[model samples]
Target chain A: MDLFAERGYAEVTVAEIAERAGLTKRTFFNHFTDKREVLFAGAKDFEDSVAKHLAEADDDLEPIEAALLALTEAGLALAQYGDYARARQELIASSTELRERNLIKMASLAVSIAEALVRRGVPPGRASLTAQAAVAVFTDAYAAWTERGATADFWNLMQQSLADLRRAVDAAPSRPSGA
Target chain B: MDLFAERGYAEVTVAEIAERAGLTKRTFFNHFTDKREVLFAGAKDFEDSVAKHLAEADDDLEPIEAALLALTEAGLALAQYGDYARARQELIASSTELRERNLIKMASLAVSIAEALVRRGVPPGRASLTAQAAVAVFTDAYAAWTERGATADFWNLMQQSLADLRRAVDAAPSRPSGA
Candidate 1:
């Protein structure tokens, strides 16, 4: 990350990244398919954790509630990496390639959550809608948490963001024509 | 699009695209930066139209309502090109590069709508949340419309998707611990 931050993401080579960490290119390739994967190393684990959490959620929970609970639980695990998260976001914001990768990661995460919701007996359409909205809440809360550095309460931010989302949706006109 | 559909997006070159349209490579570059841009040619115009619609929306509309109204109005204009839209979506889904570009375009649209909402007196946080939710609604509605082919009513789909979003959000637990 420091190498990419200093020399720009595109300019930094896999060999250099490997060398900086006192490893060979072959060893680096063993762990990551490409340089971009370095920035998204934990994405699979994060998705898995969220899925596991959702699967274990109580059967009585609403689709949206189950999805949010899973996401919040999974997201809170990242609280220890607040500074790294902020720096990673800045790096991503600076590079189109990284930003695109980040977006794809988020989209995949939403899809996984939606599928998990479906497994919990939620209908497909409602599961998809709930998962998408829950992911939005997570994204906003994560952004706020990273912006505030390591000490911010991610749990509080997630709750506040969810409240804001509910209020915004509630404010929408019941009939489109009425707007 | 035909060339991309038949030969794959990466395999199709600017020269071939221009030749297929009976134009020279220079002419193709004059209109688009690359082959990928050919698939996204009207993105700028679509964003501009959404912004224009939002700017002209009634002041009484809530932030989410105004954003949705703008997106739906702009989206309806593409009802004429439903077949084309479906083909474009298929090509995008098949190509990682195209999917990334599509995601970036949607993200930019959300940011633009959020800025428009902020200009209309909504707080920044609320504007951001509203815009993201509105975009999610637009995305699902657009997908359903295209899935049902050219005859589907884009406006009605947008309305249905928005209602689904509202119902899903309403289903979320009011307190984090309630679940």
Candidate 2:
């Protein structure tokens, strides 16, 4: 991240990155398929952890509750890497390729969460809706967190964002009037 | 659309596409920046239309309602090209490049809608949350509409999906009980 931030993502090579970290090229390749993976490799583990958390959530919890719990926990874990997260966001914003990859990663995360909800016995349609909305909340909170330089408590931001979402939905008619 | 469906998107070239349409390569280039643009050129128009509809929506409508009204109207217009839309979706699904493009397009549409909401006196945060949720509802409805071979009324599907979103959010606790 430091190397990419300093030299720009495109200019930085995997060998330089490996040398910076005092690792062999083979060792770096062992961990990441390529330079891009250095930024996004955590996404797969995050997805797995979210699913695992949801699976272990109390049976009585609502689908959104379970999903949010998992996300909030995962988000808090990410919060520990504030500087790295900010740098990662910058790197993603700097490159179209990285931005698209980040988008796909977030989309896949939502799908994984939705499938987890389905496995928890929620209907597919409802699960998808819940998962998408939950992910939106997470995304909104994350933006706020990063924009504040990651100083805010991620959990509180998640709560506030969820409340805002509820208000946003409630403010609108369930069906358009006279429809 | 037929050309793409018969031959893969990558396999089909601009020259062939122009020839199939009885147009010169120059004329095709005049309209599209590249072959991928052929599949996505309407997105810009669609985004503009959604913003226009939101801008013109009745003042009494909530942010979500305004956004949804815009999406439903634009979606209904696309419903006329059901077969084309299905083929477009399949072509996108078949290729990573197209899928990524589609993802970026949808994300941009959401951003456009959020900007429209902001113009209508919504706070930026609330506007973003509403826009993202509304887009999610639109996506769910579009998937269902396409899955059923587009035989369903797009407007009805939009309404049903919005209602499902409401129920899914309602089913979840506003905040976790112990939090």
Strongest candidate by lDDT: 1
What is candidate 2's lDDT per residue for B1-179, written digit by digit as tens? 77778878888888889998999999999998766778898999999999998999988888888898899887778877888888778789998778777888889899999999999999998998889888988988888898888987777788788888888887545554432
Clashing residue pairs in candidate 1 are: none
- What TM-score quantifies how close candidate 2 is to the native fold? 0.87
A41-125: candidate 1 lDDT, tens digit per residue: 9999999999999999988888877887888888888877878888998899899878888998888898999899888877889
DockQ of 2: 0.50
Instruction: DockQ each candidate and list the results.
Output: 0.57, 0.50
- For candidate 1, the iRMS in Å is 3.6
Deviation in Å, model 1, residue A43 alpha carbon: 0.4
Name the docking class for model 1: medium
- TM-scores of the candidates are 0.91, 0.87
Fnat per candidate, as a fraction, reads 0.68, 0.60
